[model samples]
Target: MVIFIMRITWLLVASIFHAGPGGYLQYVVYIVTSLGFVRQSFDVIVDGIEQSIVEAHNNLRPGKIYVNNGDLLDAGVNRSPSAYLNNPAEERSKYQYNVDKQMTLVKFVDNEMGPVGSFNWFATHGTSMSRTNSLISGDNKGAAARFMEDWAEQNGVSKQKGHANSVDFRSLHLSSVLPRRVSTIIPEPNEITDDLMQLASSYVASGGRRLAASNITRRIRSTQENTAKFVSAFCQSNCGDVSPNVLGTFCIDTHLPCDFNHSTCNGKNELCYGRGPGYPDEFESTRIIASRQFLKAADLFNSASEEIQGKIDYRHTYLDFSQLGVSVSTSTGGQQVVKTCPAAMGFAFAAGTTDGPGAFDFKQGDDKGNPFWRLVRNLLKTPGKEQVECHAPKPILLDTGEMKEPYDWAPSILPIQIIRIGQLVILCVPGEFTTMAGRRLRDAVKNVLISGSNGEFNSNIHVVLAGLTNTYSQYVTTFEEYQIQRYEGASTLYGPHTLSAYIQEFKKLATAMVANQEVPTNIQPPDMLHKQIGLLPGVMFDTTPIGTNFGDVSSDVPANSNFRKGSTVNATFYSACPRNDLLTDGTFALVEKLNGKDWVPAYDDDDWSLQFKWSRPSKLSSKSFATLEWTIPEDAASGVYRLRHFGASKPIIGSVKHFTGASSAFAVR
Candidate 1:
């Protein structure tokens, strides 16, 4: 039986603005995990926050904060490919595939010391890893965060002179915002074979020692020390319609661009794919894109001088989206009431975005439903007349809200929250919001916050939309975009008035916050923990080959091998399933350098240069092996180094056991 498990975690949003004893502002670091491909559990988030609090307490000192935003268009639209293919040159030129280039940054600076930490907000999708990627990664944004934090550590903290007492923070913990631009230039199918794609994916995902490392080192070396225990967050914004594949989409087979309306090649989407800035080499593309964002953020951080001063406050509440009534202004300056429909996916949703095209006959801009697929949809659940009329222009493919036999397919209840720090307001949304949708929401909320303040505030009120925060409700597109029946519109679970409903709800919250009024709590979502099911089988046991033992060297580096910078050193060992223990706060592999008589730690699994890959050698046997690869850096000191692997083995009857292995020393010159 095929089962789809929607692992959704309903987490309570933490208060970012907190005051300590003596009313001093306390720094609270909240890390937003990479939500692409991999999902972080609630327990993991709580544990991470708890750990961050301890670290922040030691490193972060309360300081003056500033907020500023700059415009730098590093991302483009993936849907533009389809528009270019389907429309005339003049018509295509008229279409504006909006790219939100605004990079907002919040920096905490100490008056006596220097820079403490920074929080950044930008809209760019994490799909730089691509769908063909098998390994888990943080994509471009994650890479940027690591680079900034590492740069801060190596140059800002440890290398600073004469400010040792003020910069006593030992470690830096990085957290990023989750907003994304859905557009990215992906590889053409024919241009890159599946094996080559996976290989490139692994190479990039492994944090290859390429342009990023050298560029970061040079940039860090050129900068002066001002930041201490610096934490950087690349948070998400309204990116439901954004794509990182900036180069546009094309047909791999014909080398022609895909159809603009449907994003299909010869009426089929399987052969259509998008391309990024660095084509052929996705890793290079990822680095280029990440570097653009980081450089822009760095510039903004340096120029930021607007001080944020006001009381810290926040308001949160959950609301049932199904059949929620919202009042919107009419074209004639009047108000009208409209209701949202139950969650349902449309046909165009199956076409997927240009970043990752879907299989079969489905295509984008498809409004009419297929007869055969309708039969299949009915076998699951049929949409009633109200639902059909409610989601007009969107041909229903899955009546997810009505289907509850096995479990809830789509969320009906979601959290809507607003946080305020002085004049900066963050609207924490539950799902992806398209470009125009996000703009409208921001404008509406900003207007409300200003007007509701009754002349207390002016045009300086900064409103930011934080998308995909509490839960996933798919996408939210503008009403006009909804009529286009594109992938974003089709995936918008609610009706065309979805964005309108969100604006209404957020305005209500904003007004309440400005007036110090209390809002009533609504119904809570059902807990699906008891209904959860695991389809993937667990590790029964682990064993080595007949003559080999666990942690035994299967493949070792060549004897007396001499390597230079930008080279990769590899070692393989007979291993067990890494799932036996997650090794949280631990290392799976390490690069140790010889220091006279004793070996000292140089790098661990957390470093971008090191990659740990696990695989089963045989299908029938429970035999596994792990390959540890370390990409040499540009600033490497000429020294002897060795690789070490750590793992755990589980037996069918007995308990789990841990083991370690090491490789022979190799020289780096």
Candidate 2:
């Protein structure tokens, strides 16, 4: 009988889910046969392992007290002359983001732990995704940390926290080595038991206060009803606990009520049936705060998941360096041969649509009791797992954010599987733009991918842009949507013109990737004529800001250059520049670095905007950090190569040169 009841209950629950959002619940019946703990699904297990790795790191060497003062993100080594990261002067953060696709905080290891140099980049596990918790994969509990530690030792880095100020939280971000100490910046975790106790006290106090008033009103009503029964003149059934006077608001009926419990409520309803007007409504205030916080974190976690998935690793760190076009084969096959590596990637992950329960099956049949979290019961073997190379976006913090103060991020969406021989990148972007709108989108994504690939792979870059997905998921779609039209703000993910624009730019990426070679550019332009001077081509960059108001991120080039709060409103790009196809001479600009002291462009007003332009250059070398070049006209005399400036809500008037007068200066031959 128990078994039968359980089966019936399961069927009922399945039916309910099917009726819910996205029509995906019905599939649950087939997806999940048993409601017990499921350990299969690689997607579900990756998160837990990541967390465990973080925990192990904290256990071994806490983060703090590093020997160097340089930025950890830019740290480099002088181990090899061929690798850029091997440069002696580079900082840690720069090395992480630019070369290793990470953001590391150094935590030198101390000698107190086990074998000194037995690991690199060890992960830890923790229950939360908070600052101090171990880096866990979604749903996977401790597996991630264990794997990370093992992987580190395998990589031949010092596993023990050598006598160094260890435990820098960002040290986990290192691709090569785990920090040697625990993180010093982690906040004390909120105690759950204490918080619950406080909540209970508040709930009881409010409950008591409301109940007292309700009792008094009920007592008086009951007495009046009793009095009406005593004074009944006509033959009638018993008042049935209600006095005539109580029933008739105008009548004044009175009586002594012996039982005190049922005297003051509304005399009819539950709180009112035997109570009075002032009864507590049983509203849970603590629940309100707790629920909100939980939801916010969940949203953040989901967003993080998306970011993790989007990470596109291009640097062939441990793989055959030659595969990235670093070297070609000399076999008689006469093929454009590249070298290969001997590593197989272990578990990888991606983000699913977070649209209601359709987002994912977090629990079996949506049962809260069975929170089918990503807990790794086992860590399978892939002794030599390859690193999934990714292209990452720099993270920007919005002041009015859900996270606590000093929140940080870098846009590496998901960890993808390392495929064989070739790779593909697909984007479900937006469509439609004013004038040659699609043009910019195409060039922008293309340039980033190309540049990123070049930096990572070294030779032929492989990338493809799949625009015009038309899933109705938008990208700041405008014209109709941008004009405050319904759902335009969120629906248009990028904007209408993104589809066509990316389509064009991706054409180059696809060509490069498939051809297994960099698509060289040979286009040269004539100098501006003394009379009929060709307008020097300019490109605009969209550094998607903290908010969607378009206030922080929106600006047309040549107008608003003072992304900083205050300098001087000089040369300004028109906020609404009419698109001109003729001037769209294939120039591009992308913000590779926007967080340095030089890039910081704010004064009193925190909100700011800035742009960089990309043009062809006459020279080429390995040290050039930026890909932008300029157009030189024959008669067009040399001038200060500059960007315009604007202030806090100020208008632009003139250009702002990097140097006093040293910009794009040259004498024609």
Judged by TM-score, which candidate is best?
A: 1
Name the lDDT value of residue 430 in candidate 2: 22
574-665, model 1: which lDDT tens digit per residue?
A: 88888776666566777766555455556667566778888997766799988999887665555667777777788888887777777777
- Candidate 2: regions farther than 4 A off: 1-497, 520-669
Span of ten consecutive residues with least summed lDDT in model 2: 231-240
lDDT of each: 0.68, 0.20
Per-residue lDDT of candidate 2, residues 1-669 (tens digit) = 000011111100000011111211111211232231122222233453455455444545432222111121211111111122222333323333322211111122333432221111101111112111221122111222222222223223233432212232223233322211011112222332333223222211000011111221111112233211110000100000111111111101232221122121223111111111111110121112112222222122212211111222221101111122222223575535222221111110001011010112211011011112222201222111122121001011111111111211111111111111122233223221211122233344446555655454322322222222211111222222222211111122222222232333344444444345544333322221121211223323221112321111122223211122122222212121111111111111211111211221111110011222221222231111111222221112111123222111111343311100001111111
Question: Distance (Å) between predicted and true CA of 219, model 1?
Answer: 24
C-alpha lDDT (0 to 100) for residue 545 of candidate 1 = 81
Measured with C-alpha atoms, the lDDT of residue 285 in candidate 2 is 17
- For all predicted structures, in order, the TM-scores are 0.81, 0.16
Residue 122 C-alpha lDDT in model 1: 76
